[model samples]
Target: MGGFRSRSESGRTGSGDKGHDKGQDNRKRQGGNRGGGRGGNKGYERRSESHRREHDNARRRIGSGDRVRDIVFEVLRKVSTDAAFANIALPAALREQKIHGRDAAFATELTYGTLRMQGLLDAVIAEAAGRPVDKIDAVVLDALRLGAYQILRTRVDDHAAVDTTVELVKANGEAKASGFTNGVLRTLTRTPAETWESRVTAKVTDPVARLALQTSHPTWIAEAFNAALGGTPDAPATELADALAADDARPVVHLAARPGQMSGEELALVTGGDEGRWSPYAVYLPEGDPGDLDPVRDGLAGVQDEGSQLIALAMLRAEVADDHGRWLDLCSGPGGKTAFLASWAMGDRATVDAVEPAAHRAKLVRTATSGLPARVHEGDGRRLAEIRGLDMPVSPEGDGFDRVLVDAPCTGLGALRRRPEARWRKTPADVAELVPLQKDLLRSALKATRPGGIVVYSTCSPHPAETRDVVRAVADQTGAVIEDATALFPDLVESGTLDSAPFVQLWPHRHGTDAMFFAMLRVTA
Candidate 1:
């Protein structure tokens, strides 16, 4: 399974703190004060105490200069010792330590930033340490990598980075190793490796290796994105590095109106983005508490990406007949797309079926589409066709579905700005492993569709293996033809030029949206 565990098995459930027993004891003590004379004051005092403890824990877990160093070390330790993923382990650690607010934000920055820049960071570390980075203890290597990131990229004080890392070493029950941590960090910070520049400037080299080391992407991914976009290999590598380096805190929230429930104008007043974009009904929200929006709070609006909305709209535009038919979201999870599809279908009197394999995510899809009239399935998309044959919710009576969306599970390289740490954690092997799974999902979605139905294969990543190659392979195998995605969604097409392939690709630097790729394939029955 490419080291990918199910969410529950991964410990992603929202447990608060893991290391401290004092918090639990305090809570129990507070419960005993429920019938006491000073109940209100005691309650306030307990809450204050809890907040202080949380803040202190945050500081200890990820201090200012040591934030990225500590987190990356922890992630690496968990990954090496427990065979954990950076994505699953890092988030769990942050939440468990009650690291929120600025401290939490800093921890996120350090962890993700170090991961994204690991290729470069490791190169620097290797040169400075005068030894291969892989030979080092995973914990010590991660700690050094974290320290390298702060010294090279961040404005954190050098002394603080060194001292705090030493503290992290000691706090981690490695008091004897604190001197080693301090020695390494100080040596590297004092004399950063000069080999990185020479490596970047060299030309006669392995393309993937060059890209991976210099651009901080797995070599295969650089090749895949380059091949998919028909661009020079160097361009995608540079772009990937830039995307990874982009600040994570600036993510924009998108708000959409519930179909026939709220107007765009109403949503605009709440979200406050430019309301005159391609999807007039959609608005981009600047950074704010989305829960503060009344419509969102009341379930009349949802927080989704504009790129995702465009994906749904592109599929809808493929074939909008007077007769409303069925729609399916093959991999609807955490249900953003499912909610949008359900709302649109409900307003148009069209039936929409959303399928998700995971129970928790499927429940989220159900909750997101609760007020809308849509069927939610807790089954895998790869098995949907066979499941339908065995009296599943999918009926054989009408057109299987007029529009089917296969938002396949991907490496998510395109959505790097949103999932800051993902770029760091993902490897070439990860993308390679996801190709077969994505191919199967797309194939299943095609088989479940009606003759004239459109199967839209979408990915948050611009990687060719996961996006273009997968779609092309499926099309060739099934004899499904590719149509012009821009022609279908003209509003989404760039205004200037139209001389190329059929799929639609949105880029962050170019489209001002998350880099998303979409291809509309018409299955010939």
Candidate 2:
């Protein structure tokens, strides 16, 4: 949902050229001897000439002056130096660079692959630099890391990686360090990346820590994932390892066909995507940018995660017999969910009031829900009562909507693959700060819902503190009953039943969607 699909599948799977090892291929080719005859000598000479020509062709393909690497450097600088998000910064750069076909694909691969493996790359860089990576100039380090990424992760010829990287460094006025950069990269490429993985992770005996290095995740996040996946006694080492690998894998783009606008089947046909198996209105994005698609640009459908579409649809599908037909989106920003909910409500002759604190995000919500019966209020959701003033009327039973969605903000660990640099930006302290606010938002959403109404609390995170713990706290304080939400999507659930009581958490490894957590709290009097 609003995710990327790269042309070259480098680093998309955690296996990064592992199955197609160039070294192993060369060994296989050189292992046997040719029969010793003059004719055989001639045959050997012909084969060697052909190999030389092939090598030269590969070198020519890696030639310079493409300007694609420049686009990549600019994005890396914005993300690393300016603390920008890859998802937001990349598109703008691609447009500004005017790169389309194979060049765009190469830029996408280098930028994302380098960022995804930044931690492991840094570890390798530090070992190769003979000092901490921090000791190098920031600009020089970024150039080196980009080079090292191609050498280690991608199938780019090693000579091309080092040569192009040195050229980039020189272009950026780091010519003095070009020799140092070239030496380090050559040393790195001398052995396979898997060998370096073994060397760097050899001393780390803890399963979580070792997995963190192997999977290119922060150690804390690795531990959090392990704990969330039923740690130690219940789940095994392989479970946590698979989850980590999934977090680093590339996520497919998902589109939500807004109700009353377009059908999922029609949208799939127009965009060449397949209809999603989970949500009725969901479509899996085909390759290339969704922005270029007519249906998306026309707002007939918008990019949204299937897991997110499922949760929003679940709130709608909940068995609410009140017939009160009113909806609210508390903390709706960048309004993907609000747009879907509002379109559905429009079909039912209902209305939706979306609350977004930030002005820019509120404007985005307005843009997303344009031409629908949705109102955007720019104010903090914690002040829900004050913000939803007398301008909007409430239900006759009480001062609240019949159905409310609280997509609270929290550590977005569930979407690490989509947001390549987010894993480095988040910390345990961020989770601590967010847990209280998440609970407060849920409480306010519950307070604003009428008795017998349904309030759905959701987050794009699998951390227990931000999900089940928050739901448990609010339910305990308010006496709200948890509905069996997994029943809403029988196809996505494991047992085709709602056995995991109280809340539903979707896993990327198992569900091919962001690890979205959902809880349906019925305001029972």
Cα lDDT of model 2 overall? 0.80
- lDDT per residue (tens digit) for residues 35-54 in model 1: 45676767777896787667
Residue pairs of candidate 1 with colliding backbone atoms: 115-424, 116-424
Candidate 2 weakest lDDT stretch, 10 residues: 1-10
Q: Which candidate ranks first by TM-score, i.e. highest?
A: 2
Estimated TM-score for each candidate: 0.75, 0.84
Candidate 2: stretches off by over 4 Å: 1-66, 233-237, 388-397, 494-500
Q: Which stretches of candidate 1 lie over 4 Å from their true place?
A: 1-104, 191-208, 232-250, 263-265, 274-278, 320-322, 388-399, 424-433, 497-500
Tell me the alpha-carbon RMSD of every candidate: 13.6, 12.3
